[model samples]
Target: MKLFHYIVTNRLCHILSTIVIAILISTTCHAAKTKYIWQSSDQFVALEQQDSPSTNTVAPNDHPATVTSETISAMLSSLEIRATDSDKPEPLFTAVAVQSIAPQILQGLRQASPTEDVTFAVIGLHNTSYGFVKSHKVTTGRVYYQAGRLNILIGQAQKEVNDRDDRRLAPFTPGSRHKTSEGDWQLLPQPGQKGFSLQRKDWAAFSTEWQPPAAVQSVSPQQSIPAGLIAPARQPSPADRLIVLKELKEKGLISEEEYRSKRQEILNLL
Candidate 1:
């Protein structure tokens, strides 16, 4: 009887071990199967409303202009790259963070400084595509630079008038889009602020509140340009244009056919 009992006990232990092993294997496989997605702070699509003129052309103070330009250039140069089995790595600039040090930097440069009460925020927008057969939410990953001011808003108007395809009113207008500022186009609001909430919300008042994240300062090459010099308005070079096109494609601003056609055109120029 003792021998029989011992054998039964040993069998039970084996079965238990097997079950434990199977569970661990299943858990491991489940974990391995999990997919990762990059999420941004906000998402938006282009609106159908007739385009309106932009009103955000406050001549930036020298200091504010310098700091913002440097911040933008550094942000672009730091495009994330992926390693592959080749000499060249592919760039993955899907996520971007723009922090504002305007108030801090400006105080030292100019006598009359921007009010200390003004707060700057970096907003991220995501463009969603429905599927191959149809389009879902049109685009994502739109960045808006908002400055909380006492009286006038600085970045509001220009961001509103631009279309999803980055089309803008002719140059020389009050809010006419400039080429050098093309890099900044995405950082502005989509046309009509469609599907976007521009007003400030009181987060403390609600149980669930959305807050803009801290600017992503991760990548490298912290470079800056002199403030006084106006970035040349010449048409963007091929490489620069490619970057813009890639962004537009990723954002779903341009259809696949449009992207392909424009890409071929740019390549032909090269």
Candidate 2:
């Protein structure tokens, strides 16, 4: 009888130890997956990180649609200008989108697309000094596409003037324009407005191949398929199906049980 009691007690202790170890592992994983929220900067300073999750929600009017490469090119083709006291309009030197960066969930901001928001690092150049001198005015900023419109928020602007001998004229004048007091979200002005007037320009000369970043490319459903095998009616491979299923589960579009069942179904195809 004593031997039976000892065996039962030993088994119970082992089970309890296993349960505690599993709980610790689960907690560690949850903590590692925590992401930081960042705030937009005016001086283009390093983004401030926040520990809490963002509570921001998108409004109907501000929700962005899925963006394509053409959409980005279209936005970059237009230059924003503001009417000055003189007859000639003053160019705001709006930066053009040169590279696409992965969109992040910003606090008090909405996603720019179905899966994520679209962001771009932009650059603009103009002549700070009159004539065909070597003096150049450069502006850098970030562009966010939302509500079918491009919202540009200039981060920093500086004028670098060089002499006829290619010598430095000034010590890189900073903040050449008037200081902007608007918040990050408030900087987005409607098209044709003073700060956001869209003046069309010939952008074909400046065109470059635009490809989504690697992070965005990985989530594409067609990434694993060969080019020759691509067709409108072609069926997705088991690997492709599994990739999509996992994405849906991560996005919370499917429940845990549904994910497990669908995942098993895709694995069976292999």
Q: Quote each prediction's TM-score.
A: 0.21, 0.29
**lDDT, candidate 1, residue 225?**
42
State the displacement of the C-alpha of residue 267, model 1, in Å, after optimal TM-score superposition: 0.8
Predicted structure with the largest lDDT when compared to the true one = 2
Q: Lowest lDDT 10-mer window, candidate 1?
A: 200-209
lDDT of 2 at 103: 30
Candidate 1 accuracy as lDDT: 0.33
lDDT of 2: 0.37
lDDT of each: 0.33, 0.37
Let me know the TM-score candidate 1 reaches against the reference structure: 0.21
Give per-residue lDDT, candidate 1, residue 223: 62
